[model samples]
Target chain A: MNFDKELDARGMNCPLPILKTKKSLTDMVSGQVLKVISTDCGSVKDMQAFADQTGNTLVSQTEENGEYIFFMQKK
Target chain B: MKKMAIIATKGTLDMAYPPFILASTAAALGYEVQVFFTFYGLQLLRKDLSSVMISPLANPAMPMPVPMPVMVQMLPGMESMATMMMKQKLKKHGVASLQELRDLCLEAEVKFVACQMTVDLFEFDKSEFIDNIEYGGAATFLGFAGDTDICLFV
Candidate 1:
């Protein structure tokens, strides 16, 4: 997936990963894709909910080993 | 925006984290968050929390990687050590400090309401806090809480 920025939220727990993602996405241009890698199992649900809440589009998501990879296109 | 109200009632370090963390998270989730700081909770909005310490004596469930007994936690200097350890852990996790969290709340447009009665009772000066705060009484906070779909006392 093409991404304008990357956020490595591995090892971070709930809220931290999402908060960091929110902060990073705030600085990016609209319609840019943010690639997020998180180890928190909850990130699967958290990112989807976050994307919906913020009006961002979840372009793609996949899991490799334990890491949750998500591609979000900012609205 | 959906609204969320939080009641913060403790001043200890362990007690201080939840309100901000949850408030910021709710804000990120597209909720218009409001935090009512009353009684000891006022310390969370204090101008300087650099001296805040966790009450290890009261929190038995604290996630101390190595659990310590009550007597050991009661020893002199243990509380400060624990507070430092917790702060370090938060920093290591890339979590924002209290001041930064407060700024995030402001950035998120989270409404911070200071309890008027508590301030009057404690004889605290109003000027001792950061700017952009709103002052209100129990009724004011209750009115907001009543209107909010998600409200809790943290």
Candidate 2:
């Protein structure tokens, strides 16, 4: 799916992936999608928690080749 | 978003990290987070602060990735060496630097409370900290923590 912004947090750890996603989401209008790619296993839980708390939508997420891909929509 | 309050009490590298990490994450999660620094924690608020020291004397939690005798940790220069190793490990894991964590906390609007009593007792130069840090006593911090879902002392 197409996204409004893409953040490559490939090597970053838990908090960075989520924190960067949040910083990006702030400028996004409601309904805009953000694509985040991360290698850190902990990002999965962190992003999920972040989305759940911040009222953002964790539209979809999948992992391939050890990299977790998350598509979140700004709420 | 509800409120979260963290009391940071130590200046060591290991001790300083928990508040920064937890408070920043809480703020990012849409919570109003407040971190109150008292005692040794005031060092982290200094404007020219560098990396913190590791208290190896009794820190069993300190990771020695390579197998080493516990007594070896007490050798001269070992504390600094351990601190340096910790910094490198943190870097290798892509963990944000201490300074970056602090900046992120502030950017997320995490309220930073500096204890006025400690400030006066230690004679800390008030000019050493960045602006936007609120100076308060126990009453003020407890006021913010009054109804928070999470209240932590780190």
Candidate 3:
């Protein structure tokens, strides 16, 4: 998927991934997509929750091997 | 905008993580977040966090390299060892340090309010804490808490 920015949050746990995502999105224009790759299993649900609360769209999420990949669109 | 009010009353290393974690995360999610530090919890606002150590004594859930009986945990230097082990584990998992979490909260504009009563009761110098934080009593916090969408006491 095409995205305006990419955030590598691998190895970070809990709020770090979410916080980094929030920070990254603030730099992008609305409707632009962000690609985030994370290794924290907890971030799968957390990313969805963050997107839900912030009104940002989690365009899609997938897992390859042990890494979780997420596409988020800024609201 | 949603608002969150958290009352933090414990000062232990393990106990300290929750409020800061929630506050920062809530702020990231677009919530107006406030954390009120009272009693021992006020230690979190201290300029130096090096003294914050986790105690394994009486905490059976603490994951030590070996199963430690409470009697063994009570030995001298055990707290330091436990704290070191926990720190290593957290680092291995890429968890943010307590200082990092607090800094993140501040950067996210999460309001940190120190309990004035506790400060006075403990005779703590105002300069001992970080800047850009408010000092207030219960009523001051309740003003925000009463109308908040989510309120927690940690």
Q: For model 3, name the residue pairs that clash.
A: none
Weakest ten-residue segment in model 1 chain B by summed lDDT:
B93-102
Chain A fold similarity by TM-score, each prediction: 0.96, 0.96, 0.98
Ranking by lDDT: 3, 2, 1
- Report the lDDT tens digits of candidate 2 across residue range B15-37: 88899989888888888999999
Please write out the lDDT profile of model 3 over residues A4-50, one tens digit for every residue. Answer: 99999999999899999999999899999999999999999999999
Residue B101's lDDT in candidate 3: 97
**Predictions' DockQ, in order:** 0.53, 0.81, 0.96
How do the predictions measure up, each by TM-score? 0.87, 0.94, 0.97
lDDT of each: 0.86, 0.88, 0.95
Candidate 2 regions exceeding 4 Å error are: B66-72
Model 3: native contacts recovered, as a fraction: 1.00
For candidate 3, the per-residue lDDT at B80 reads: 89
Model 2 alpha-carbon miss at residue B76, Å: 3.3
